[model samples]
Target: METSQTHENSIKLTSTEDGIHLDGSILWLDSKHTGDISFLSNPQSATSKLDSRVIATEETIRILESFRKKPKALICQYNRPFAIGPLNMELLPSGVGLGGASLWVETNNKKILYAPQLQPQNSETCHHMQVRKADILILSAKTPYNADANISRKREKERLIETIKKMVSANERPQIFCEPYATGPEITKILSEEGINVAVHPNLFRILKVYEAYGSHVGSYIQHSIHRGDYDTLLKPIPQNKQLRRVFPKNPVISIEDNQGPRLDDGLFRKIDERFYIPSSCDGRELKTIVPKIKPREIYIFGPYAKDYVRQLRSLAPVVKALFPRHLPSLF
Candidate 1:
C-alpha cells in the first residue's frame, strides 16, 4: 500500500488489496478485511458483504431487508454517534437513494467523512445529504462529466411531469422504467404529488412501501394489475425480459428512464411510442458547488469520472485524489 500525506495534517491514506485504509485502521467502501470495520454508505454498498461488521443506518438495514435477508450489522440512526471500540461514528443521510447514508468518523482528534454517494439537494423520497467539515473527504464522482451533469433535480422533475402529462393527453399510458430502489420511489412520489395517478409494478411497490414506512411521502399508488386500467402512468423496474410488453400489449406505451436507457430484452424496445431521460444524481457542477461547503483539507473521489472530477475539484481542496474503486458495482 502506498501512503500519501499533506503538510498541514499527518493523515495517511493507504490503498491496500482489500480497500483504501485511513491511518491503517479504518477502511472505506470495501469490507473484505476482517481487521477493519466496514462503513457501508448505502444498502447497495452492503449487498456483496453482509457478514461483515457494517455500520449503517436503521433505514438502510430496513431497505436491505425489503429485498434480501437481514444482514449482520450494527444498526445506527442519522446524526446519532455510536462507538465501535475506540472510534466514534455517525451515519448521515447521503440523499442518493432510499436509506443511503454517509459515514462520519472521529478518531484521534481528527474527523473523517465518507460520502461516496451524495445528492446534497432535497429529494422527494430520501433525506437531503448532510455534510460536515472533515480532515479527509471521500466523495463520489458518479455523475459523468457532461452537459447532463448540470441539470437540476427540480428541472428534471418538471420535465418528467410535462412528459407524463403530454403522454396522458395523447391518450398514451406512460410506462416508465427505472431502478426499483433509486429513482422509482422518487418518481412515484413526484407524480403522486402532481395528482397523477400511478400504478407501480410489484417489485417497485415493495420498495415504495419501505420508503413510506421511513416517513417518505410517496403518496398514493396502486399495484399494477392487468384488470385495472385506472392509472394515468405505470411505473415498472427495468425489464429483464419481454414481460413488460406482454402485460401492457394494447396500451400505447411511452418509455421513460434515466440517462441510461432501460436495459430491455431484445426486440422489446420497439413497442414504446417515446422515451425520455430523467437524471437521478447530481451533476459535476453541483458537486463543485457542494464540496466547497464541506471544507475538507484533502479530498478523495471514487466513481465513473473520478479523474476528471479530481481536475475539476482540485481548486476546492488543498489535495484532491481520484481514488477510483477497483470494482465498480451497480448502485441498485
Candidate 2:
C-alpha cells in the first residue's frame, strides 16, 4: 500500500478498487461507485443541481448490489457503521438534505473525518452533533469561493423574506424554480407559515409528500403543482378552508418547479428585483467556524474550491489540497 505520513499518527489515504483503503481495511463512503455514465441518461432531468453541477441518482446508486459486509451498527441514529478489517468505518449523515453520508474512519486508535460534500443548516440540531475531534479531516473544495461562509441560516431566511416582500410590494407574483434535491425545505417551511402561497412541481411534490407522511409539518403546506395557476391532476388531499384559500390571493405566490428551461449563468437563482429566491446548500463557509471546534490534526480539501480560499482553515490545523481523479476510488 502506498503511504505518506506527514504528521505524527497520520496516514495518507488512498483509493482502492473496492473502497477507500485506510489502515488494513477498506471503507466505502457512498452507496455505490460503479462509475457508470450511461446510467445518467438525460443528465439534467435525472440529477439534483448544486450550482452548475448535477448529481444523477442512477450514477449515485451505481448498482443494487449488497455490501460485502453489512453495517454492524448505526451512528447518530441516521448514519451506518461497519467493521471492516482492522478499521471501524462510520458513515455520518449529511445535513445538506434528506439522505447523504460523510465518512469517519478509525484505525490503530487514530480517527479520520472525510466530509466530501457537507452543508448543514445552522438551525439543525444534528449540525453540532456531527462535529468531533479527529486526527485528519477531509473537506470538499467546491464551495462558492466568493460568498461569505459565515452567513447564518437565520440571516439567509430573513434576506429571502425581505426580497419577497419587496417584490410583492411591486405588484408581481414570483415564480421560483427549485432544484428537487440540492435545496433543503427550511426556507419553504418558513414561507408556508407566513401564509404565502407555495406550489411545487409535481415530481418534487411527490418527494415532499413522503416527508409529510413521515410527519413533516412543512410538507402539509407545499402544493402539488408547478404554480398556483397551473393545472394539476392530483386531488388536494385536505379540504381547503376559506382562510387557506385567501393566503394565495392576499400574498405573492411562490412556486417550486423542476428545471423548466436551461439554467443561465447563475442558474435558477435570486435575480435583482426578481420575485424569487433559489436556495442552494452548496456553500461551505460555515466550516470556517465549525472546523476549528473539531480541531483535526491535519486536513485535506477536495472539491472545486480553490486551495487559497481554504487556506484560511490552516489556522485550525495543517491543511492540504488533495484533488483526486473522478474515477479514483480513494483520496489517500
TM-score of each: 0.83, 0.62
N/CA/C clash count, model 2: 7
lDDT of each: 0.70, 0.44
> lDDT per residue, candidate 2, 1-332, as tens digits?
22222455567554332223343333433313323111111112223321212122221222111112222222223344656467666655545444344557678888888665555553231232365578888765544443444544466567766666566567656544344443434445666666565665455565555444434455234455444563211222111121123223333334321112222222232222222333333344557767776688787665445364456566777655444444532312
Top candidate when judged by TM-score against the true structure: 1
Instruction: Tell me the spans in candidate 2 whose CA falls farther than 4 Å from its real position.
Output: 1-9, 15-24, 35-81, 123-129, 144-146, 149-153, 165-171, 182-184, 222-284, 326-332
Regions of model 1 farther than 4 Å from truth: 1-9, 14-19, 26-36, 46-49, 147-150, 239-277, 325-332
The root-mean-square deviation over C-alpha atoms between each candidate and the true structure, in angstroms, is 4.2, 10.1
Predicted candidate 1 versus true structure: per-residue lDDT over 186-298, tens digit per residue = 78888988889999998788888888887888888999978998999998887655345454565655555553223443245346555555555566777788787789888
Cα lDDT for residue 173, candidate 2: 60
Instruction: Give candidate 2's whole-model lDDT.
Output: 0.44
For model 1, what is the alpha-carbon lDDT of residue 243? 43
